[model samples]
Target: MAVTQQLARVSGAYITRCRASAAVSPDADPEWDPPAEDWIDLDWSPRFLRDACELAGVDSPTLEALNYALNGDASVDVSVLSHPEATGGFGPTPTALTPASVADVAAKLAGLDWDRVMAEIPADCRETIAGGDFSGDPLAYLTTHFMALRDFYVEAAQRGLFVVSWWD
Candidate 1:
């Protein structure tokens, strides 16, 4: 089976509910299906995006923003991704980011110049990218998903909601 990544903008109340559910039932189901409007289905884009950013020498908050975009800050204690029996193995735990962090990341992403960043990717990195798991134009793929992710963060930040992400 293929593992896809996703993120959701959730209210504080929802986080509390997840925590309560986990505390009351350690064997709770691990399937997390946020409302369609609140979810960002990233497919298999994060790794490619991160690798491209690293190769392009993307710096500081931008790099950090990309990192947090997928690997969220583990602020909550809910084990929403752990279901050994159902999944046959333990997936990554769902992690969250506070509204403030979401805003910070949105700002960083907004500040990035996509074209310049693409041009900055070193030749060796391009070679590595050509040999990567993905086909076609990796930069184009990253651009599409990066825009979606940036928009998602921007909306979440505007709503002052917590963002949760997981791999499963």
Candidate 2:
């Protein structure tokens, strides 16, 4: 069956389940009444839907169904709210530091013995780091930084250090 059809079927099943689980009025038409907004509000984001699908090991058809349930036919952008906390806890936590405070943090990080960590990076990465090409080839610099951070994380983990989870 097509993914869209499968999704629709799954959605039907979900609605059926919801109706069965709830007390229905005999004279009331369940199909005529849509679910409450709160029902849809709970974990209805595209990313949440995608993650749920992945975790449930749902097939493409089921995933399509899940997507349809969340937001019908429209292509949802999961990256819409990249930093939720930045919007005063509605998203990500806002940065407590001002520009000067951020600069101070950067200066402190710069003073650390990063040379030893950077030495482990491959030769190709060194060129990108040395060039400081933040505008062009940001990925190259990001890759290098990611590796360095990964290495640091591994070392920290080995020592049983607690690392806070943060999405890149």
Candidate 3:
């Protein structure tokens, strides 16, 4: 089975459920249940994840440092192009994204040199991408998909909401 990456916006109801779930014992709230559904699905392929992560302005020592500082450590960004799982996001999860962090990601993504990013895609990753319809325009593909991801984060952050991203 192929493991495609998935990102979703976490609703307030989901957050409430999470808090309640954590606060209450498992046996207490028979009606309470862990969140199992996603509200906003930003479906991104592993190859896209790989390339976006390495985007010129998107990947920098300073940006990574800030991200690490903002978000603790321990959320795995699984390997897309033979890369190891990345623990702790600059934003939140795989679990959450803050207003500030979402803005940061948007800014970073907007300022990215998409051409440079696509040009830098590793050989193995390129091979993987070649298997799909990614030959048209990498930057365009990234913008279309990443824009959705960015917008989801921005909107969620603005509403004091959180977005949970995980892949199964």
Per lDDT, the best of the predicted structures is 1
Residue-wise lDDT of candidate 2 within 37-126, one digit each (tens)? 211122112343244235434456544433433333222221221233211114331112222322332333333333433444454653
Q: Candidate 2, after superposition: displacement of residue 78 in Å?
A: 24
Q: What is the lDDT of candidate 2?
A: 0.31
Each model's backbone clash number: 0, 7, 3
Per-candidate TM-score against the hidden true structure: 0.83, 0.22, 0.51
What are the per-residue Cα lDDT tens digits for candidate 1 across 1-168? Answer: 687787889887776675566557757754444578998878888877787778778887689888987888876554554555322343576678888888999889888888887788886676456345667776677788889998999899999988888765
Ordering by lDDT: 1, 3, 2
Ranking by TM-score: 1, 3, 2
Clashing pairs in 3: 74-88, 75-88, 93-96
Give the clash count for model 3: 3
**Alpha-carbon local distance difference test for all models:** 0.76, 0.31, 0.45
Error of 2 at 5 (Å): 39
Better of 1 and 3 by lDDT: 1
Off by over 4 Å in 2: 1-134, 166-168
